[model samples]
Target: MVFEKDPTSLYQIYPTTVAVIGARYGDELNFMAAAWHTLLSFNPPIFGVSISPKRYTHDLLMKSGEFTASFLGHGHAELVEKLGRTSGSKINKVLEYGLELLEPRVVKVPGIGNAVAVYECRVLESRSYGDHTFFVGRIVGLHYDPRAFDEVGRPAYDPVLYLGKDVYVKIDRSRTIEFDPEKFRK
Candidate 1:
C-alpha cells in the first residue's frame, strides 16, 4: 500500500462558498464572504476559517468568540461576490442583501439563510498568521435542507465555485467526471 502518515500534499485545496458571520461586542455585527475555510476535525466537529486581519468580521469574531459558516448555492453567486467586494464595516451586509438571519442555539452570532447548509460554531482556538487569522471552532449545531438530499441520501448542492480574483463559477456535474477510484485510480 502506498500510504504515509499526514499526507497533506496529496489533497488539492479548492475554493468553496463560505459565509462567516459574527457579532462584535461593542461594535456592529459583521458578515464576511470567505473562501478560506476547512474542516479540521470530525469527532468534536471542529472547523477552521480564515479572515483577514483588517476585515470587520475578524475583530467581531475575536471579540464574540462565535461564528457561523454558511454554505451557499448557485443562486447565491451574486451575493457572494457582493459581500467579498465590499466591506461590512461600511455597508450592512445582511440588511442590504435582504439575507435571512437565524439566531444560533448556543452562540450569540446569527446564521445565514440562503445557505443550503449551516454550521453554528463556537470559537475553540484562534491564532494570527501573517495577514490573516485562523479561528478554529467547535461546531454546535448543523442544519441542512431536506429537499436537497437525493434518493441515495446524499446532500446535493447547486454549483458554487470560486475562480480567484473576483471571479466565481458554478460546477456542473453533468459536464465533468467525478471521482471513481475503481475506474481510473487504483
Candidate 2:
C-alpha cells in the first residue's frame, strides 16, 4: 500500500546518523547534533551542514570560518541526545556533557575524542535558505578510530541513527550487503 501526503511528511524515510558539529571561537568551544549534513565533493573533500540561524554554532562559524564534523558510534547515544537538547548559547556543552575533545591537527576546532570519525573543515561559503543556512566547508584533514574498521578496512561500528522525536536506532550489520554495481550490471 502506498500513499502521499504533504512534503513535510517526507521524514518517514529517516533514522539517519546525525553528525556532531564541532567548532571553536577563540577560547570557546561547542558541539551540536545535526542530521542534515552531506558530502558535497571528494577531490577537495567538501562537506555541508544545514544549520538554523538560531543555533550558536552558526555565529561561531561566521567568525572562526572553520569547523569539524564528527560521527560517533552507537555507544554514544546519550551524548548525542544531550547535545541535541542543550543550547550552546546557554552553556558550554563540552563541559556540561563531560565530553573529551581531541586536539585538531589542521584546524583550531577540536573534535570529540569519542567520535569514530572526524572531518576538519574550512568554510568556503554559505547561503541562506528559508529558516536554515547551508554551510559548505572544504575538508582540510580527517581522523578516525581504528577500532571502527574491520580487517578489510570497512566500517565495523554499528551505525547510530536518529529517528526524530528523541528516538534512536542502530543498523544491524548482519544484513549488510557488499554489492558491486559494475559486476551485477545487466
Among the numbered candidates, top TM-score falls to: 2
Off by over 4 Å in 1: 1-15, 24-27, 151-154, 176-186
Error of 1 at 169 (Å): 1.2
Error of 1 at 88 (Å): 2.1
Q: Using alpha carbons, what is the TM-score of model 1? A: 0.81
lDDT of 2: 0.89
How much is the lDDT of residue 156 in candidate 1? 76
Give me the candidate number with maximum lDDT. Answer: 2
RMSD of each: 6.5, 3.0
- For all predicted structures, in order, the TM-scores are 0.81, 0.90
The weakest ten consecutive residues by lDDT in model 2 span 1-10
Model 2: per-residue lDDT, tens digit, 1-186?
233545446677588888999978998899999988999999979999999989998899889999999998888988988998898999989778888987899999999998889999999999999879999999999998888898887778876688877889888768878888899899
